[model samples]
Target: MHPTDSRSLAGNVAQLEAGRQITVAREDGFEALKALLPPPSRRALVLIDPSYEIKSDYAKVTACLRDCLQRFATGTYAVWYPVIPRPEAHDLPRRLKTLANQSGKPWLHATLAIGQAPDRTTPGEPAPRPGLLASGMFVFNPPHTLKAALAPALVQMEAILGRGRGQGHQLEAGG
Candidate 1:
């Protein structure tokens, strides 16, 4: 299921070819998320990939995760975030760690930095370098076999990208 706030995107999704079982909703994703939660959802994979244009999105994501866990603690949530030079982006992983600690749920934080961040000498000037410097995913209640399966894949990705200086993955288990 995909819920988008943009009407154009919603229209595009609706125009997709047949045989697609996608439930597309043109509404605020955070608000739409609650309605999608099944009462007896034993196992689920919730992917939260929001455009962090506004700082409030970070807080909303945290709140949504908290509520989702309260309703379905066994569900696995994968939050994808861009690795940018912003306070919210920098603090997301830490916030996720706090949430996992509070719930006593094991989580995994994996980051892939394709290249070094731009060298910004000026304080106010925007970082000029581009081409996806970094990206990360925080997985809550990860599968038991996830780490073993992803370890070698991450290594291969790092080798393929040719940027081993800071590109790597980390897994943290909750008690």
Candidate 2:
């Protein structure tokens, strides 16, 4: 279920002709996440995409992922994070890595930059304004071939989506 109750978002989702079911949940993401329980035999994908407008969202994301890992350790989880200048943004990757180590889970982290950053020294923090300069996806329990499969695509995306200097991509994996 999509973790949003916005009428406009629900209306937009209704327009999608996806073959499978997609429910727009009318509740908090944490509540929806807690209620979900996939069977052990089946594989599931849990994607957490936050707007990161509030500083507290960074901690919330970590907490949400920890809960999901406890409930469904085998599921593939991907977290989409913006690359901004904030210290929270800078530390999220490391925090996720620490979590992975503690959980003994394999993880993959990939980033894409489409233009020059406002501050080179602080790449993780995106500007608090419009337009995204860079973004990253941290995946827990990624497939063995996921990195190989994505390397070329990341380069292609950099070329196609890049706007100015500092346009590039980085991919790293660890357990």
Candidate 3:
């Protein structure tokens, strides 16, 4: 009973169980992802990587996300933005907040930075590794069960990705 015909960005149709879903579209970009959902309700998850530099794109992403939130009965939004060496990273949460506020729904938001400690010394290092210190997944409207499912994986990814003192961390819901 599952819909196994859906494709992904790589053009592979998944073989999932009944009620399982998969989508692969490039025309509309992320909007295509949102369009795959059937009306009425279901949990929603959004993951943005390497946060787009364009404010307009970010606004669109948040708008589409807000629309999904309002349309769904109960869903969580997970937006992943890189902890780049810049000030804009700090402004993303606020921008998302503004987007949600405009939507008039109380959406939870969190930020996590995955990369080396900015204060670490690199005197003799050939060059600082370009990767996350501790990649994080920020969730808004997260399900109660998500924490348990992700906790272990985060630890593992952090340990593998962290340089010196890698610690894949979760900021938790409402933190």
Each prediction's Cα RMSD? 5.0, 5.9, 6.2
Q: Report the Cα lDDT for residue 5, model 2.
A: 45
Please, what is the whole-model Cα lDDT of each candidate in the order they appear? 0.78, 0.85, 0.54
Model 3 lDDT per residue over 22-130, tens place: 4344355556656655434454455555235665655666666766666663555667766555555556667666655665545544433344555555787676565
**Residue-level error in angstroms, candidate 3, position 126:** 7.0
As a whole number from 0 to 100, the lDDT of residue 78 in candidate 1 is 95
RMSD of 1: 5.0
Task: Candidate 1: list runs displaced more than 4 Å.
Answer: 1-22, 39-41, 117-129, 163-175
The TM-score of candidate 1 is 0.76
Q: Write the per-residue lDDT of candidate 2 for residues 70-101, one digit (tens) a residue.
A: 98889898999999889999999999999988
Q: Tens digits of per-residue lDDT for model 1 on 24-46?
A: 56567788778777545365788
Cα TM-score of candidate 3? 0.61
Pairs clashing within candidate 2: 83-124, 83-126, 84-124, 84-125, 84-126, 85-125, 85-126
Best by lDDT: 2
Q: List the residue pairs that clash in candidate 1.
A: none
Return the TM-score for each candidate structure.
0.76, 0.80, 0.61
